[model samples]
Target: MDRRLPVAVSFMAATIVAVLALPLELQLAVLITTPSAILWMGRTTVQHARAKEDNLRRISEIEQTINEIAGEELLLFQSRHPNRAETVGGRTGMSAVFATTLNSLLMLLVCVALFGGKHGLTAQILYFVFITAIALDLIMGAVQLNRYVYRRPPMILLEK
Candidate 1:
């Protein structure tokens, strides 16, 4: 079972509630904050996936030695390795990032449509600063995620 499914759904639900519960000004702040949070989550997922993949490669390299060891010892080694756990955790992390990105973008659009036109100078400054920051964060995250992706298959087989 994909453990991430429930978590992804719950996050979506919570984000919806948060959006609905916030006032317009705070909602705008949330919209700005969400993208950076998503980016951070994405970076974490990529790092974990890389670490897991590295551990798996190292274990595989010593598979013969591991096989010669006692069953309990091999089991302990495998348990400590992040093979399946990484895959599971990566799925959840990536899903959360994706969902968060979309949620933030949607909220951003909504905020702009609702409260964009009537802003004072301070409000306008805050709006521009937030928009720029969010955009940069999203772009940086995309680059990081793309780094992992581009390392594997260019356009053919997509593993991990």
Candidate 2:
């Protein structure tokens, strides 16, 4: 499965909803799905890491055979390459999240300024949903950032 398919779907859904002026709650829910999925994926990654730790001996043994033929230096290089790539990807992802967070904040402020005075129930509910979704997005981003920044080193087969 394409890793980005969920994000693309979420973006497209949100765009279409906004353009067509769909029901506001549905719009907020659709927009929230992407960050919720991101948080779910992050949780899965953490679980996989824990499982790897539990089976570290088996993993190391399997990797040891490959390292023997490929050489330790090659194994080290291979490990470093993925780590570097992940770091770069994480940095890019964080930047996007930050921009989205700022946009959400601005949107929230505007909604409050424009609709706060009006006591229309639907508008009020929509505002709350929007604020909640934005909060969730920021939270998910922070969790992802924390995991990225403090990530464990890849379990290389051989020690330097």
Best by TM-score: 1
- List the candidate 1 regions with Cα displacement exceeding 4 Å: 1-21, 64-115, 118-122, 148-160
Cα lDDT of model 2 by residue, 38-144, tens digit: 44544444344334333443444456567888876444432443434343234444444454445445544444454443447885787677657655765565455
Summarize candidate 1's per-residue lDDT along 1-160 as a digit string, tens digits.
Answer: 1344346446644664576577877866665555455445445544554554455545554664575674535544544555434442245445555554564456445544544545577886777677667656755664454345212223486799
Q: Pairing residues by index, what is the TM-score of model 2? A: 0.39
My TM-score estimates for the predictions, one after another, are: 0.45, 0.39
lDDT of 1: 0.53
lDDT of 2 at 136: 70
Candidate 1 backbone collisions, by pair: none
Off by over 4 Å in 2: 1-69, 75-78, 81-89, 120-133, 148-160
Model number with the top lDDT? 1
